[model samples]
Target: MAHAPAPKAATAAPVISRMLVHASEFRLNPSRRVVPAGVLIIQVKNIGQDDHDLAVRAANGHILKVTPTLHSGDLGTLRLKLKPGRYWLVCTIPGHEGHGMVRSFTVKKPVKKPARRR
Candidate 1:
């Protein structure tokens, strides 16, 4: 009789990275920014005493909605896979955006090849 080989073990998938953005005073701290092109994890913390939302718009007029509404002291998270491009981040709470609660940012593509040797 012949002996059997051992079975291989399965591996778990890696977790997607995230970016934290706090919502307060109708503004986002570190307003202007950039992220790597891939899965994006948005952590929204509503510090105001009212409901707020995290709305995003792409350069091509496409809308990528994050949190619809978050109550005071509440937290909302959105996981989205995005491509490299410019996007607008805003809190669509009445005159929030108009009150300087909106900001623009970009998603840069990760560098592929390393520098060539001399």
Candidate 2:
């Protein structure tokens, strides 16, 4: 009998940006930081042996949440847009927040366009 050809695997969308958050005693890697006001790509890698969540609260009281059940050597990514302001990012897992998995970051406004010359 003749054999059939193997199926090709689907390619994933390329990540424009990435942020690595390591799980530890109540804190994210690089606890405090700043990002530009635009599409922000965040990748959370759970270096610990437990599942973790990535959450963000905007200055306008909006919330974004992502939970990745990270087994050892696992990772997840979240793509989001942020405005200029101060925001809070945290992992709300039980006992995780208190342990220091919370962090604060600022988003700056995009530069304005230059005026046209006559």
Candidate 3:
């Protein structure tokens, strides 16, 4: 009988990209203002006493993604696949956006590695 080959070992652990935001009565604070192009896991903590939500808009002023309304002191998460450009985060609740519950983030292009010489 032929011997079976051993399974290949993992070279490295897959990176878990994440972001944090604090949602209050009138503002959204993002931990990062810029990130590279890829999928990002966003976590939000509602620090205010009112219900709030998080929405992301494209550079052209169109909403791309949004999370459900979370109660006060609740934690929420949103996963977004970002491309190279700018994006805005806002709350869509009545009078929320008007009250300046908005923020911005930028996605930079991924750099290519140099080719190896023969």
Candidate 4:
């Protein structure tokens, strides 16, 4: 007689985090100031009349990721896996960050749910 096939192992669902960023002439606004550590998808929209781009920087003064230049009314997206720490979103264009085009946000560990009692 033939043996039955092996059962597949169970896996946990992945955690997702999302953020919306608005880029203007002299400012960058985020939808939220905090999120859980996991895969993060950031949607950047250029709401100003000038071309702009977004750069993700860590608290250690290192640039993590950057998006392509976006013209007025343009949109771009950036996907990253972030850990529990603080990050900054800024426009790398000349004189942009100095002109108030920067924002700081935080990420925390995901909260674990309590197990059900029988």
Worst 10 residues of 2 by lDDT: 12-21
Report backbone clashes per prediction: 0, 5, 0, 0
Worst 10 residues of 1 by lDDT: 11-20
- For candidate 2, the TM-score is 0.70
lDDT string for model 3 (43-93, tens) is: 999999999999889989998878889999889898888888999999989
User: Candidate 1 — which pairs collide?
Assistant: none
Give candidate 3 misplaced runs (Cα > 4 Å). Answer: 1-16, 112-118
lDDT of 2 by residue, 13-90 (tens): 432334566765556774338776777777777777667777777767667756565565577777887767897777
Task: Please write out the lDDT profile of model 4 over residues 64-113, one tens digit for every residue.
Answer: 99999999999999999999999999999999999999999999999999
Name the weakest run of 10 consecutive residues (lDDT summed) in model 3: 9-18
Whole-model lDDT per candidate: 0.78, 0.70, 0.88, 0.94
Q: Which is better, 1 or 2, measured by TM-score? A: 1
Clashing pairs in 4: none
lDDT of 1 at 17: 57
Among these predictions, the greatest lDDT belongs to: 4
The digit string of per-residue lDDT tens for model 1 on 14-110 reads 3355777788877875333888777877888888876788877788877787686888898888788788888887887889889877778788886
Instruction: Write the number of the candidate with greater TM-score, choosing between 2 and 3.
Output: 3
TM-score of 1: 0.76
Best-performing candidate as measured by TM-score: 4
TM-score, one value per model: 0.76, 0.70, 0.80, 0.92
Model 2 residue pairs with clashes? 26-99, 26-100, 26-101, 27-100, 27-101
